[model samples]
Target chain A: TQLLEQSPQFLSIQEGENLTVYCNSSSVFSSLQWYRQEPGEGPVLLVTVVTGGEVKKLKRLTFQFGDARKDSSLHITAAQPGDTGLYLCAGVSGSGYALNFGKGTSLLVTP
Target chain B: NAGVTQTPKFRILKIGQSMTLQCAQDMNHNYMYWYRQDPGMGLKLIYYSVGAGITDKGEVPNGYNVSRSTTEDFPLRLELAAPSQTSVYFCASSYSEGREQYFGPGTRLTVT
Candidate 1:
């Protein structure tokens, strides 16, 4: 079973549109991270939220961690073709150094 | 800095065959990890090493083995390749615990 659940497995939107992708889990996490991966490349770290109800911004991209620490969300404003890629969410579980990853959200923005 | 490097970007193996996937990091990170990502899925950890001599299994460790003989090298070995093992393998490294992991481009393997 997947430790982290992400909604809207696939997303396709026109440029300049706004969208939000979510990651949910039953267990709380110490820190949650978001990554963006392009085809044939490794996933790049976009942001990390450690506090409950915390919010972070990377340019036009926004990330929010649920107050309960069991969920998180990534919102992109005025999406561009450059944002097309796989968005993944990962959380630190138990006391281990490994991260539990969500299946991911595949986003495609057409110009 | 060539953060992390993986060999043979693509490979094809027959069932029951065996091979090793090489991973190396130049960031001087003591922590190294191996993960596999299936089509349309997230990455699942296969194994990780804390230092030069310590290694541990992760979520999907079956049919795989790992060795960390040095701080900069961590290679994953497959004793018997299976169709179920076909996926993109990624190697990552971090400076310490709970830090951002830097990943390699990945190795796409296919078992026939």
Candidate 2:
């Protein structure tokens, strides 16, 4: 029973294509964070959204926090092969000490 | 600033063997954590420390032990390793609990 669920467990796209990954949960969160992990490496923080309905952008990547603070989404524009990696979303819950992570979405971008 | 550093980037352990995974952070973060990542699964927290001498179990604490004697070091110990323990282990540090965590390169453990 994953507290947070990510959709499209796997994604493969061509260069310059656009993709969006969704993370949903029933419980409200104080904040949501997005991370990217590459093979043989640990996950790196991409962005953190704290307010409901807030949108943050990092380069070609955009992160949005749901109005209810129960979900979040990450969108990548004009994907490139270098963008291939596993994306993960984590929710900050209960006084902000622990993080509950989603199953993660594996992305592969081929040129 | 080295951020977080974990030792033994790769290790192979035989069943029933025991070993310790070393983690050190240079940022002087007060909060430290241990997490394991399995294939196709999100990181599962094993243990965490709020400060020196204050340790707590997270979602997955079984088969693992941790001690935080200093602010910069948090080591994870695995006793009688099992095949199920084989996964990539990551150590993270943060200025505060529930804040953005900085991760190490990760240690890959394979148990046979």
Give residue B95's error in model 2 in angstroms.
0.7
lDDT of 2 by residue, B55-92 (tens): 99999999999999999999999999999999999999
DockQ of every predicted complex: 0.73, 0.75
Error of 2 at A5 (Å): 0.2
For candidate 2, write residues A1-111 as lDDT tens digits: 239999989999999999999999999998898999999888899999999999999999999999999999999999999999999999998767778999899999999
TM-score of each: 0.98, 0.98
- Residue by residue across A3-107, what tens digits does model 1's lDDT show? 899988999999999999999999999899999999999999999899999999999999999999999999999999999999999998757588889999999
The local distance difference test score of model 2 is 0.93
Model 1 achieves a DockQ score of 0.73
Please list the residue runs of candidate 1 whose C-alpha ends up more than 4 Å from where it truly belongs after superposition.
Answer: none
Clashing pairs in 2: none
**Which 10 residues in a row give candidate 1 chain B its minimum summed lDDT?**
B93-102
